[model samples]
Target: MEPLPSLEVIKLDEAPLAFTLATLFEPSSVLSQKLVPQLHEKLKSSPSPPTSYGELIGLAIDQVRTWNVDLQAKFISGHPRIGETKNLSMLSAKEQGANSDRPTVQPTPPKVLARLAHLNAYYERCYPKLVYIVFVNGRSRAEIVRVLEDHLGLAHSLSIDEPALETADPVDVGSQKWLDELERAVRDVGLIAKSRLIALNVA
Candidate 1:
């Protein structure tokens, strides 16, 4: 397989399978050890590989959702946190519109960042081993905060309705709301990846 291509080398239709994987996901050994190989096998058996990277990423997300909970968590958690201000990948930095080179751009306010950080911490506590991941998709920090707040409220309501989830196994908890959140996160991962691919000017 070709060495993982730099961001400059990833053109959806032309790059090798590993290039697409690296472009779509953060660096995770599980991706190299599992997801990439699985996708390669899938492409081999298909009548033809997907013409668009977006479709390929959708299939990857579907495969992730079918894995065992631990594996799913590993894959899902590879995504960056919403409202993160630093240490973003080139793709994530572009996706979040953070650290722009244009001088006219204003950064998210410190107060808003603080609130998001607090909410992120609370959210992780609410759902162990899960990070708050959203597509951001050009939404403002305040708007993203509202989404996070709404999610926390929903998680709280679900916990109240199914208190047993608190004591259930961390990896195997069967709460519908938690499971739904996981599925949503995986879906967002696809959305983010596809949008990034589009931004790459994939042909």
Candidate 2:
């Protein structure tokens, strides 16, 4: 939970930059391969490096916006699924109540819970190596199912005649609701957690 060194320091020191990126992403993730170089370049060229953790978060997610599928999928895979029993990060545990101490938190309905789990697995099959990212934001299970089905249906309809746009940038990819939602989830999940780290002076 150490706060990152100043962006100026990280800009000049490769070791610090790499460590900072590791704090934000899984070790050996595409973030190191795809995003860190770009961020490093920006840091060197810009008249000012990020002065605050919030600015750093913005820079990181902007790099995220440009990533192709392989990188994005790798980034997405780091997150634990909502309500999942394991692999939850500090942020996910707090946001999704994955590690709540409260005993009164109601369990999901049996059938609906099963369906949600099914959809998560089905999504992985549809886009191999990619986990579906959804901004849970306290939504109910039924609502999450609708969001999942809606995105999956959009992807299915678009790929009816051809394979989906595997390489297209999520933001620039043609009118795809599924991709849009996925990208937003990616941004939100990371931003919220990173911002929390910033506020607490944690790296």
Candidate 3:
């Protein structure tokens, strides 16, 4: 993969900042709108923008989490569900083993996909507005399904409700197990971005 231009070049324009954020996270006009200005201000605040990808990503993560929980949940939900089979962002397609840049990998079997879909529904029902997001990182569908099953075991299958998230303490938005799932999804977003950053910089 072609390496992104140096940070020095990227900080020169909001366009590059938007592109970089979309590449690292999923492409979302809402997310870009919310993040690009903060990133630009951050870039301007320092004489030197973050000298490393890690610091830049840290800034991105911190900014996202500082938003209200509803927005944060929505942003995390923007990620394609695990085992999703359609309209994947390039980074997601590559990580899930189905990018045009790589040699063709066999399509996941319909049966396995069906199982994943069922599990995805269960997971979403268990925690409203939060989709199951994993790094995938090259795991097979079967393996991912197993992971989902294990996660479901930990989660309480509850009647999904529209909680007053805006006024409620963000930390208590869900059961502790549910919160753990959200935290894991957030961590995986950073992990996925780090992996993508590494791959893009590869020699």
Candidate 4:
């Protein structure tokens, strides 16, 4: 196992919803068995059921869109001067000569900051579960372990890199290696766990 690149926590505002939704909705070889079941449960508790797949997807899409909108609103309110400062020092010699020799002091707009704060609050409230996916790009096992311990708050029961496992092809050697490493890590923490390659693939 190698230490992977630091996983970036994409802010809700920064995410491109259309791209994310496209990827999420595309059919993959690794589908979560619980996805449909969980969706069904949620729908049963809801006031109304979606009439079609399009409607269902639309509902999900709308939720994300609404969140972004709310975040943008809050950001705008909190930061009002986001785009008004000019710096003479950083400009080209010709431009600098036209202005004073002082650095620009453009502050974040109050409205934008407010919107960002709102989005942060919404994400924290909605998704308490912080999902982390690690990708190995040729680093040492010790470094990876250290990073996992320091930043991710890994626990005995917490699944590591679950999405990777879910998306891995069963016949691929790399996937098998990934499974082996994950299982080893789990067992090292004294948990009795089974790999999907064994349980799902075999079954």
Give the best candidate by TM-score: 3
My TM-score estimates for the predictions, one after another, are 0.77, 0.63, 0.81, 0.18
Alpha-carbon deviation at 76 in model 1, angstroms: 1.5
Candidate 2 ranges beyond 4 A from true positions: 25-28, 98-115, 125-129, 137-175, 198-203
Sorted on lDDT, best first, the list reads: 3, 1, 2, 4
Q: List the lowest-lDDT window of 10 residues for candidate 1.
A: 156-165
Residue 34 miss distance in model 3 (angstroms): 0.4
lDDT values for all models: 0.67, 0.61, 0.70, 0.29
Instruction: Tell me how far the alpha carbon of residue 67 in candidate 2 is from the true structure, in angstroms, after superposition.
Output: 2.7
Q: Mark the 10 consecutive residues where model 3 has the least summed lDDT.
A: 156-165
Highest-lDDT candidate: 3
Decoy 4 TM-score against native: 0.18
RMSD in Å for all candidates: 6.5, 7.2, 6.1, 22.8
The residue-by-residue lDDT of candidate 3 on 1-203, one tens digit each, is: 44566678767787777777777887776677788788878887777678877778778888887777677777787678877768876667767764435633448777777777777776666677688888877777767877777766533222232222232222235677666767788788888888887657631
The digit string of per-residue lDDT tens for model 1 on 1-203 reads 22344323333323366667876777677777788788777776677556666677878888887798778778878877776867767777666654333312247777777777777766776777678888877676667777877866533221222323243334335577678878888888888887766556662
> Model 4 misses residue 64 by how many Å?
8.2
Report the alpha-carbon TM-score of model 2 versus the true structure: 0.63
TM match of model 3 to true structure? 0.81
- Model 4 Cα lDDT, one tens digit per residue, 1-203: 11211112111211232222222232211112222333444455667665433444445433323333333222122211112123211211111121223223333334433433333233222222212223222222333344443433333222333223233233222354433433332222111111111211221
Error of 1 at 109 (Å): 1.5
